[model samples]
Target: MIVAFSVTPLGVGEEVGEYVADAVRVVRASGLANRTDAMFTTLEGEWDEVMDVVKRAVEAVEARSPRVSFILKADIRPGVTDGITSKVETVERHLAEG
Candidate 1:
């Protein structure tokens, strides 16, 4: 599964980058196949591991602020892996063929 999520602390004004970084750090430390883009951090793993990471990441941000906002999107295609990179690569390949 590929889970792309964005976590942010609410009521914290404009300075949420540090809190977001904390969440990203948790994801990185998990050593799962992951990617961090401007909007979302994508984690590739089984359902349990992926949800665990997301929960912990939310906790990291929640620690700083009383309220938090989180958004998640998941692609659960069984018998497949590396969708984080490979899915984008496949699209780019199709574009190149044009």
Candidate 2:
């Protein structure tokens, strides 16, 4: 499964990069396949493990801010691995071929 999530700390004013970084740090340390774009951090792993990472990431953000807003989108497909890169690569291939 691949979970793409965003944790935004509310009531922390406009600048929340530090809190966001804390969440990303937790994801990076989890030893899972992951990627961070401008909007969301995508985590790839078993369902339980991925959810645990997401929970820890939310906790990281919560430590700094009074409230947090969490958003997540997941792709859950059994018998799939490396979907993170392979999915994108597949799109890129089609684009290149066109």
Candidate 3:
């Protein structure tokens, strides 16, 4: 499955890069198949492991701020792996063919 999520620390002013980085750090340290774009960090793994990483990431931000806003979207296909890169690669392949 592939899960894309974002963590925003609220009531902490306009610049929240540091807090966002805290969450991203947790995701990176997990060693999961992942990519962080401008808006979301996408992770590919089994259900438990992926959710655990997301939970830890939110906690990382929660530690710094009283309120945290987390948004998550998941493609929970049972028999899929490496969708993090493969999904994008598939789209690129199609575009190239055209």
- TM-scores vs. true structure, each candidate: 0.97, 0.99, 0.96
lDDT, residue 32, candidate 2? 100
Query: How many clashes (backbone atoms < 3 Å, residues ≥3 apart in a chain or on different chains) does model 3 have?
Result: 0
Clashing pairs in 2: none
Model 1: lDDT equals 0.94
Looking at model 2, report the run of 10 residues with the lowest lDDT sum.
11-20
Candidate 2 regions exceeding 4 Å error are none
Q: Which model, 2 or 3, shows the larger TM-score?
A: 2
Cα RMSDs, all models: 0.6, 0.4, 0.7
Residue-wise lDDT of candidate 3 within 1-98, one digit each (tens)? 89999999999999999999999999999999899999999998999999999999999999999899989999998887787888889999999999
Supply the global lDDT for candidate 3: 0.94
Model 3 residue 80 CA deviation (Å) reads: 1.3
- Candidate lDDT (C-alpha), each: 0.94, 0.97, 0.94
Error (Å) of candidate 3 at residue 84 is 0.8
- Quick one: ranking by TM-score, best first? 2, 1, 3
Residue 97, model 3: lDDT of 100
Model 3 ranges with Cα > 4 A deviation: none
lDDT-wise, the better of 1 and 2 is 2
